[model samples]
Target: MTAQNLLVELFVEELPPKALKKLGDAFASVLADQLKAQGLAPDEAVVTAYASPRRLAAHVTGVLARAEDKAVSQKLMPVSVGLDASGQPTSALLKRLGALGTDASAVAGLKRAPDGKAEALFYESVAPGAALAAGLQKALDEALAKLPIPKVMSYQLETDCELPGWTSVNFVRPAHGLVALHGSTVVPVKALGLASGNTTHGHRFEAAVSPVVLKDADSYAVTLQGDGAVIASFAERKAEIARQLAAAAAKVGGGCQPIEDDALLEEVTALVERPNVLICEFEAQFLGVPQECLILTMKANQKYFPLLDAAGKLTNKFLVVSNISPSDASAVIGGNERVVRPRLADAKFFFDQDRKKTLASRVEGLGKVVYHNKLGTQGERTERVRAIARAIGQQLGGDVLAKSADTAAQLAKTDLLTDMVGEFPELQGIMGGYYARHDGLTEDIAFAIEDHYKPRFAGDELPRNLTGVVVALADKLETLVGMFGIGNLPTGDKDPFALRRHALGIIRMLVERNLDVPLGSLLSTAIDDGFGDRFDADVQAQTHTSVATFLFERFAGTLQEQGFSAPQVSSIRFDTSVVLTDVPKRLQAVRTFAALPEAPALAAANKRIGNILKKSEGDVSATVNESALVEQAEKDLFAAMQTTVPAANAKFEAGDYTASLQALAALRAPVDAFFDGVMVNADDPALKANRLGLLKQLHDAMNRVADLSRLAT
Candidate 1:
């Protein structure tokens, strides 16, 4: 009946750095979940997870030694089948009772319950609770089975027998120890061919003791830290590293700060049990290389955090997260500097060698490199992109913009052949910019060539200049149109070409840049220019429509993410002629109009009008014959339209969408009255056509901004 907090730890070889945090979180959560499900832990129990380079552990509070017993009801066969005609126990009933550990003597106690119109016999019993040892073992097994291990390793375990042999075991890493403690008592459980104990090893080199003997669940972290010289909690270790990094950077005393990279910080944290931040520096001569190249080389190859000055320029000084804290830190600093010098040198060498050949000369090598087997070589892809860029630039500006965009697009992918990019593919566009500047190209062209790959991922910034925008648009459009033309559409979550991202990039560029170009025209140009004569005319048309639809769908999702409601977005009818840049204005107008008091009635009336037009057989025109409207309500509605339509049309034409939608609010009363009094399907064909024509006029005037029927609930 008593409750106690529990502690569990798995000691093994170093875990995968990238997967350590996930594994630790999953282990704690799954084990606690299993305990709560089994009634061994309270509903409000607190679970704390700890992970180090060599161990994964969890502490759970309010865990019971054994779960409480529970009453269970089990359904049996129908009463008619279980009993004879006289209501006496039959052989079947006796056999069933025997299987339940009871006999016919107890059959009279069975209760009959209605199950789906038939009476069925039910047997009730009290199920015994699971003991701590068995429950913990089951929880441990389930937790291990569900861990998100990136990869598993198979290894042979050491045999206790004198004979030279080994037992094979498969796990994320080889396990040497497991510790399970309930309060201060050890819980006997087995995993990975090892029995649970209260003993676990700590820091390989700095632990004051060989193996830490945990005293209790509450004292696990404190004991580990004091005796083992290890910060057991992953969060605590990361925080300590951050604190030390800040202090070390401050001690360097040049207004220098460590580069803020969460991924690098986490990886470095996962590599050390006790972090000790140390400042080190390479030769100042290495600063001649681009800071990106040097900083990347240090961070990627050496796992060092390069410092930055106040202006955000990389300094020669960097910080290393050392595992050991030695009194004399010179050795550690000297050793790290020596190790990083060669990495920086390699980066410098690549940069210097890549600048030797101009981007123009490297353009020829792209032909040898295949971009996609079906899409042709990178050389052909560049030309396609160039054509698209030139066309787009001309529409946005004059020949000057067009020429700059063309040059940028042509040289954009040439960096794919550079030595720096060959070593680090992530530096492709970056190195291209550097090479372009070195080749004596204008800043605009160089920047365009560098930033053509801008907005590569979600939330990334778009190109800064007009020329860059043109080239970036062209590059993304080429990929989307080319991929969609070949029938390689993204299905479900499998977007191999990242077409969804490319579509979103296009949408962002149009809407955020406020580009005046129609989305349909842009897609058409991309398809026609990129795939010139490669496909039949019909196929090109279909591809254009499909790609445009895809972009609009992505746009709708983005709008919703920006806090616009689904109904608001859906109300705007997206078509080929619809300019994407105008969508935000329309959505804002719809939102404003929907808030007006008269909106609901007008929306409903518009819905009715739309339904009538959809079902009508003949062409419905807005040319209403004035004499045919005989009803007083119809005459009043017509008079109101004559006054309201002109003002709304003027506002719409002036691009004042909100005012246009607001102008229709005055007609709400007239609209409701007409809908109430008028019969659209009149007995006389001419009268019916005239009434339909008046409604058609009303519909057109009300919906120039957006389809109001979509707002009707």
Candidate 2:
């Protein structure tokens, strides 16, 4: 068998920019996988993916013309059934052999094998390998079927018949051409109602030739670039666009650079083939609007990159990635400038109009806006947030902080009534901040309104001020409690309310800010205090437990994701009452305790003590009588704890978790000896009770910081 490089290309109408890269990568990977699974490609085959505005392509190296033949042994039937009594073939055996394109003569060579308890007849044959054409057709079909297309389009195709009839073809886009080549030869394959050929169209308009003919699999990219006037590889096109943007920014001769957004760069790469970076500008008056507003419109609507100065302020100039490289780009620049000016003007208009009314004046409008079907309007939700925030603020700071948080929470969702937010819902909190500042409110209130939605995603920053933190906590808890009360809990990945993110955000704030408030108390206030009549008492208690459990589970997952070992994270018995602020420190202390020389013995002994106490028939009290300790091992352990437990308790109370766990290491020898020499369930009832009490004391002390038993393995 001979091996050769392979090329596959599918040309269609413009693809959805956001989904192009994923589709291309999936197509190449799945196709290569299918080929390899069929033995038509080696395990070490190299695959390259190419995608553009109008084409998806892949080049795989070291593909065989046909897969190698395989030797197969298949069980036919029970030997007893196939061969009657003696050594004669039965009618059933003859019929089975006929189905395999063989006759009675072939039964002489059949082998006998045992299947389970009974002996069975086995048929041995050599299965011929699939040719490249058939293997590639299967691979191509699988690849297309597996692509992560955002949406599919159905179009009619004209069949090649004496009387041509329209046939419908469904794909991500209308397929126009397909190219499949092995070395320099075309492979016979069909897909999307089109036969595979060695030619493809590229660049729509700028292509130097129509129906660009590919010479070979190895030369596809080079030939396409030279004659098709296109850059076939998505990565190369993206890098080229980036290089051009940087160079164009440098040519502007100021301390200015294009705003860095990877998603924007990727989308623009997919929107063009031969990227020609051109500088365009809008009026400087638009800079009076917030840079976020301007940047959002440009990237979201026009897919343009906004320029930023050394001060990180939006500049009047921006960069455009044009597909065509015209000799003089003044017209292109002017056209883009003309197109963006109105968008900037609209933003300015919205900003100016939104400031005419203070956030407080718009509070009544939220009553009409629905928040959730079960949970009243946004107005009602706002009131609940205010109550929760006030409660949190009183605990964190005094009455003064409570007043600020209440005010901030009251006006937080007012921006939803503003035209600016109506046009862009992502700017709800941000626009409210601007309006608050305009209304002569304090920066504290303004920033809190802006930051109440902070940590909206993982790795995002938390609120900058105490007021902001208090409000953010209140808002997240309200949603968590409300949704859980309604049984809208997230299942797997279908988090319509983004409950997972909300839970993680709460965990981040509690842990990072080191807030001292109990998680259970916050859920309690949100359910009972804030949402008074919304949910019944039973629902409140259940929601509190459910939300608390959800938060802790998310927190534990976060700790594990941050590189903590599973056992370490699991060591902390997280529950509704566990203070998240103390978890990181406890985990660190556990890590330190695990490294001690006596840690293994202590951990194993602690595990044994736990099991013994669990198996006790009745409740075991930690209070042990010194007079009842007859065994020398128990006496030694009690004596050791008399000195050690006090010191460890003092360290634990002082928040020196590491010191506390380390102090218990001194009892490792005594604990090991006690377990080895003394039976917890003694013959005498008093002795058993005393031993159980002593073991309970040791278990409680060892597990205060973390369950050392978890570290046993």
Candidate 3:
């Protein structure tokens, strides 16, 4: 196969950078799949995509001009199945052969079935070779015609574009022009009725006002910077942003690092055809306002990256990235500065106005903010969070810092009403901490008040502070139990309350913090305490059960993430009644133990013992009758268990699950030996009863460590 490079670009006015990336890759995958489906694959294909706000370009290398021909799979009736009583082909089979362009005279012998089924099989498919490049061209034209250009619009003039008169492109921004090329040749194709060509526009500012006729793909990129205004790559744009921020901060001697806002960087990166970083600052008086207010103002209102000093203090300066190397750089900077001053002033006003009222006073305002339409107001929810935190704290003992939780809960959402948080919603927790400290709250309480929202996204930092961990648990606990009580569980895409996040947060707290709150009992207490005066006993019991199942899912996921095999974790968690909050840690121990060579043999022995003991399920416990015990193996097994039982209990009491499992492994040898040497189902009634009793003891003892028989290595 000869090699060729395919270059295609859709020039747009200005696209959402994020959306452009999705579309670029989407178009690449679509084209690749289409090519393969048509059997028109090249020796190797690669699509290099680039997009700025102005354009989306995907260049496919080693392009095939056509798709491979598809061999039709005809479910033809075999001659054996098709023949009538006279042994001649039936009229229906002849009609089918005629429809498929096949002649019965050239038919292969009837395929026969050697198996039991009577229905005969037919001939498999084979493809005849055809022009691969022609197939590719046809498929390419069809795909481009149907290419998903969402948010497309039409203009009156139609130059053979896909739509009548004018058409919309598959983007929020307008698809101004497109360039398509196959190696050095222009692959003449049309979609939306527009013909494919190598003509492109340079940077909307720098290049010719009209479309550019590019000689080739490589020069197409380089020429855009020199002639056109477009800077086509996100990587180049982001590097420029970083450099500018560093340079700007250095000039002020502010000693700051860029905040590294991924979302802001992406959005700003799109806005420029060519990116240049510029440093700017606001009035020093504006610095008196909350740092969050100034930061959000610049980033949200002006697309600026806020700089922070060495101690993580917010500097008044910001780094603004621009797309165009504008003729009037000063005017662009001045206009942005002027636009953001009023936003900062509004934030300061909200912050000052909020400080006048106490957090406790703001609690009343929470009543109006709905936690869920079904779960009542934020005020009610806060009460439950505080109550559950205290209850869980009691179970966890000193590490919970219950008093700190109570204080934190009081001030947690109070910041929701503050000017800082009102203007910058992301600063809710941070603002709370600042206000708490300003109000002379204790350090633990203030930290908890802010840190309760930790582990915001997957792989984000967890709350390491003791007070914060407790309060965060309390917050999630309340959300989970309260939402379940009101019947608003997450399903499909309908997590109106974000219960998944709350559950995930709870898992992180338990697994990472190693808090030993008896999960089952803690949930029960939350249920009882949270709805002590409201729900009936029956409703409370059901709600408690539901919440337990929810927590179990969270624990299982957390355990699996920590490297426990899913099967082992699931089998251990099969029993819903056993609530393990620190399940991930325990499962990790179990997995480590299970990985040892001894585990499989031990598991087998336990399963053997379980099968024997299951027969004695409803029977009365066999009180040992030394006179009735006839087999030496049975006596030895009983004696072994009696000694192992006390020691196993001690290890379990110490919460050393690993030691407990190891001690339980001791039973494996005796139990297996006993089964080999002794006949558990003996003819003699007295002997049979004694053997079963020993097996029961074996099952009961090992179960204390874990239901290990169900676990798989």
Candidate 4:
């Protein structure tokens, strides 16, 4: 089969900036996949995706003009039913053959095959290949149907003829043109009420020509760039924008660079076809406000990339990605600066107004705002958090730390009433910190208030200070306990309150900071002392169990994600007294122990011992009577424990878990011999009890760091 590269493009109005990249990729991949499925393109065909503000396109190499014919064998029916005893075709066989465009004369060519217990007749034939025109039409329809459109717009297209009727069309944007070319020949295909052609329009304002005519599949991008004044490839255009942003920032001197935000870069890439990076500036007075507020407003509201100095502080200058390049760029820069000045002024006004009333004065207003209907107002939640924070701080530090935590927690949610935070809700903790410093509060409290929401998402940094860690822990714990208490738990992916994030935050604090606090004890304090009169006694106990289970499940998943084997994580039993800091060490010890040569035998023996203990008639104690040991194997096992148990226990007590587990390697021989020679279920009751007790002691010693039986498999 002769093959040639293919090109397809859909030109439309400006697409949704965030969804353009995904839509473009989906369009190209789906089109190529459908072509491959229809045998019109080879499996190893190279697919290149091109996207701009007004276009989605793809170029696939090695696309055949028509798919190759394929040999196919299809099962017809049972041989006995298809043929009579006289060796002639039955009416049913004739009818089935007729449906396949065959007749009774073709019966002799059919082959018989056994399909299970019964023999069935099979028909073999060569299926004709699909033409590129039909294959591409199917691919185009499937690609358009599978696009991840954020929203669809329905528009009416006027009939080209004098029908005087409007045809309704639905698409992400209004499609103005489509181009499909197999090499240099135009492929006849249609989409969104438009016929495919060899030409496409681009650069709504700066096109070098009216219609960019593509000469071939290979020339589409170059031709579009030269004649249309547009960059067709999304990745190439984004790289160009980034390069220009860097150049523009460097031109402003002072070691300035555009703030690094890939999402902002992608959005800007989707909003422009030519991508002219221009440096714009606002008044220096606006820099008095926190850079987070200014940078956020510029990026979020205006899609501008703000420049930051060497110290990572926001400068008055910012970069804008304009769609058109003019001989004199001053007008565009001035227009953007004028448009952003009012936004920056609003942020400044909010900041100045919020500072007039200190965070302390705003604390009382939180009562009016409901946090959750079942969990009371933000005022009550703040009180609970303060109580929890004080308790955790006292345990971590002394009275001074506790007082600081309480003060920080008291003012943490006061930012909810701030004008700056009200305008930008994402700046809640951030604005609180600024206000705290302005109120003459200590830096410790200010940082604590600001960082109480630290580690909001995965890979985010933890709280910077110990005070912040304490408040963050308390705040997360209070939310977890309160939500679990009210039976508002996360189901599937619908975590409306971000309880999963809050749980992970608590885990990170305890483990990363090595807080040395028992997770159970913290939950107990939060439940018993923090939320006063909120949950009843029964509800409190149930909530503790539910929350603990949920946290342990999340912790286990986290350990697995960190590259620990499932059995290793499973061995470290998560319980009320399990300290989060100790889990990783224990898991490492389990991993080390699992690598020993005697590990498998010991693990298997430990598993057998567990099964034996579970099946024993009465309660089996860890205490073994040495005098009752009759068998030689049992006596040897008991002697081995006398020296090994104390040494292992000492290492365990000293926190040398790996050494502790390694000590048990000496007993593997004795354990194997005991299982081989000893009869655990003796006819004599006292003898049986002694053997069971002996096995119970061995199991306890082996599982101190982790349950060794989990490593058996």
Candidate 5:
């Protein structure tokens, strides 16, 4: 049994709950990796991470007492400097002579030095130790100290240093102290100048000013409870929150679900030192605004959860979680209600004012604002989006969004001119949607008005409506084309325009929406639209290819994120580099193709085919004359290819790349036979031409699927 454990906590003013939730998981992953790197194995374990607005804490259990012992060895040179009769280290023999401690004879055999400066070195040393605790602690400290915090504070200790805090130890919040223990004994952590000590504290509001001394990790929770805090583990927090939320909901009315505000729940969990649930309500008139509007106002403005009634209607009721237990609970409820109503009222007013103007009536406003310094006005962008959206809509077999998309694109950014959207830039599409609907535009246009910014994050909702997808793609393409046209392309980590995210957003839209338009055509048209007269055809091709390659790499990354390895994705995702709509199928092909144990052999044969074809220098037109065949293997391989061609093309055309590769897989046997039995060095040039032609034909056939020869085993 191991008696070691690690407990870590970082104090900050207040952390957002979403970030706080991922922090614990990320920390555990990195910590576990560090532990394994130190060669330590622990038994049953527990790591509890809790976050309050003010602090983030973690307690790890079942840690080992020390890192496993390790051996360190230093290599000694086997040879002395190979010196010539001149007594100098020979340039040619220097590498052969090991560093120092080389052979005495080898040194003596070298040309003797007058000063005898050429002596062999002493041998190397080896050491072994019981535990690498120092190394482990150092690594742990480095990782913890560098843990990324989105925001930080000012420090008095290290003024010049970038870390935020008043103390010399710059931390995200403040590193008031640390407590490192191994089986109830302080381990004396002096790392990063924040030494481990005999004491720690409970939730700031709960145990206020009290020190907590825990015997071990298992008892840490007990100590927290005694000090009025809940150990903030996701499992524990979720279970408790769910239980309390359900019980609270049951009392009000049966079948009430805790509003599905995981983000809200997470934040509240961290905001409270002790977890408690309460139900409150505001005036129901606020519900007159869109439910989404109300929710965002509550979430972004008030940090409250908007509960839903039994019939799934937005209720005026909300759930407030307070950290401190005040004497009069209704006073707290009244206070929160007081804070939220004004924000909601402002939102309602914006909704009312925005609806007063027809969306089409405001289209002229788009031309007044500039989207980019060089890329013309927002009206120009809208024109480009309209053109592209119409194209995408046509492909989706809908003329509805084709018109609505064009309309939405024309007016999407017009909302930027509105006072409401000007005040809250993040509300561009949202405000547009409300105003468009108010203007009595079709629901399709109204939906597209808001849906253009979709898939804002990974796993975020995508545009489900056809018109929305059209405008979304149009908007993204305009951004990509316009940015690339103006030479504002992303380089390294510096993307001033967020072009990468915009490109990724476009890809996710294509993949999730299953839009089937050829990415090449779309980009080509986009390039033509943006730089029709500005650049020569050569320049356009270069730009198009660059944009295509960028999109392809991002698409490949998308595949990789979905559990595909680089090699597997690279092989199939290579030249098939069309649009994201094609990735799922291509990824499927890569997986199926790689699954064949014979892939290596097939790859080898394909390489030969490519090399042979290249060496033939575009002479595939040379016909294979049966009589010109000098060896049966050459004749047989030629015959096999003739049979494989039609089937390969058919299967490939049917999107059965898996079956196509399978058909090609059959070539392994005949390909081996042909290579083994045929010698292309026949006296007859016709036979040579015939053989080369056959190889060229086979190579061209495979290239249609992908450049398999580029794959690594």
Candidate 6:
């Protein structure tokens, strides 16, 4: 009945930096969740997670020492089997009672209840609740088993005789100690062959005390920070590091700031217990290399944040987050600077050596590099992209654009053969742009080489110029059409080739750029020209539809994330012939039209017409027969359509989709009247066919911008 806070800690060797945060979160949440499920912790209990390089811990408040006992009802065998016809206890009843720790004397206490079609006997009793110690042990076991460890290590425990022991244990790292406490009392739990205790070792070198003793669950963080020379909370440590980084950057002046990278910040936080940010500098000469090369080298190789000036240019100085703080920080700064010199030097070397060879010369080497076993070498893929780019460029512009796009696509992938790109694959297209300038190539070609891989991930910027756009479109299409042709479509969550990203990139280019090129035409060009004879004839024939569907699905998902409702997207997406560039205009028009007072009635009428047309046997004509229209409602609707259709069609042709859809709002009254008074399925076949034809014309006019029926619900 009494409640107390709980603390748990697992001390081990250094954990994987990238996985430490996830492991700590999982450990705390799972342990707390298990306690709540077992009734050992209330729903209002607060849980705090702590993670460092050497430990994973949690502090939970308002945990019950033992869960409350509860009454339970358990079903027993049928009454017929438990007792004879006369209602006397049978041997089976006695055996069942005995198994339940009772005897024949308790048989009379059993109750009979109807279960299904038969009467069944039931036993009722009180079940004892779980104690904190046993519950914590179970929770601990479950948490450890569920950790998202990147790799597991196996080690043996030492024995008293100092001989190698045979008790092997597997964990993310070798476990050395464990601490579990309820209030101030040590909980009797064991894990990884270690008993629970109140003391834990802290920072390897800077701890003010050898072992930090926790007084209570609430005091764990304070004690660790004061005596252990460590910040226990992962979030707190990251924040402290960020604060120090900002302060340090401010001290540098000139509006200089440390480069912002969340992942790098988290990784550094996981690598230290006590963070101390110090400034370090490299020679100004190293800045001659592309700042991307220098910054990446510092972050990836040294885990440092390169400082940037007001103009967003990387400076020679950088910030280092060290685990130790000393009275004088000069030695740490000097040592880090010394260590980073070779990394920057190596990047400079790669950059210098790479520029010696032109991208055009590197083209021959791509022939030897395999792109995919099924897709042939990079040389062949580049040729495909070049052909596609040229075709797209020709369609969008004249011979000038086509020539630029072809040249850019031909040289785009050649950077993969460069030393800089080989060492840093993230800089593939980036290095190509730099090398193009060094080779005295035109700016358009150089930019196209770099921007061809634009919008590589979500939120990334698209190609900056027309040549870049043409090449990027060509590059992505080549991948999508080729892969789809090979039957390598993405299945649920398993996109090994990142075809989903490629498709989204294509969609973004088409929709964002508002390119006039048709989706089907682009696919056809990429297949028939880019990958001629590379795939089976049947696969080639189906590639356009399959790839277009995949791209449209990605587009629909994008729209949903942008706050468009599913039905709104569905209305436009249902038409495969709908131009990708025109989708936004059409969706905007639909949204605008839906706000009109007539929208609801017109949508419902359209739905009715759609259902009637679907069930009809023969093809319905769009031309209405005025002579066959006997009802005034039908005649008025037909007259309205004739007048409205011309105006809507003109606006639609002028690309004023919003205006086009808004023009049809006048028909809502006549549409409602026609549906209310007219019987579309008449007794006479000619009259019925003519009425159906009238509705068909109305449906076509209403849906020019979007399928209005989708808004009915």
lDDT of each: 0.92, 0.92, 0.70, 0.93, 0.68, 0.91
For model 6, residues 35-109, the per-residue Cα lDDT tens digits are 999999999999999999999999998998889997877787899998998999889878888888988777788
lDDT of 4 by residue, 641-703 (tens): 999989999999999999999999999999999989999999999899988999999999998
Ten residues in sequence with the least summed lDDT for candidate 2? 520-529
Per-residue lDDT tens digits for candidate 3, residues 417-480, read: 7767766789989888878877878778778888889878888887657778877887877777
- In model 1, where is the ten-residue run with the lowest total lDDT? 527-536
Tens digits of lDDT, candidate 1, 1-713 = 99999999999999999899999999999999999999999989999999998999999999999999989888878999999999998888888889999998778888899999799999888999889999999999999999999999999987768897889999999999999999999999999989988899989989999788999989999999999999999999999999999999999888999999999999998999999999999899999998988888888988999999988999889999999989999999999999999888899999899888999998999899898888889999999999999999999998999999999999999999988988888887888999999999999988898888889999899988999999999999999989888899999979998999988888888888999998888887898887876767888988988988898899899889988899899999998888898999999999999999999988988999999999999779888999989999999999999999999999999999999999999999888899888888999999999999999999999889999999999
TM-score of 4: 0.98
Better of 5 and 6 by TM-score: 6
> Over the full model, what C-alpha lDDT does candidate 6 score relative to the true structure?
0.91
Number of the top-ranking candidate, with lDDT as the measure? 4
Candidate 4 ranges beyond 4 A from true positions: 160-162
Error of 3 at 485 (Å): 1.4
TM-scores of all models? 0.98, 0.98, 0.88, 0.98, 0.78, 0.96
Q: Supply the global lDDT for candidate 2.
A: 0.92
Better of 4 and 6 by lDDT: 4
lDDT of 2 by residue, 23-70 (tens): 999999999999999999999999999999999999999999989999
Candidate 5, 55-174: lDDT as tens digits: 555666656656545544332222244445775556535544454345444544443223334443223333332243564466467657556666665555543357765545555665
Q: After superposition, how far is residue 85 of candidate 5 from its true place, in Å?
A: 20
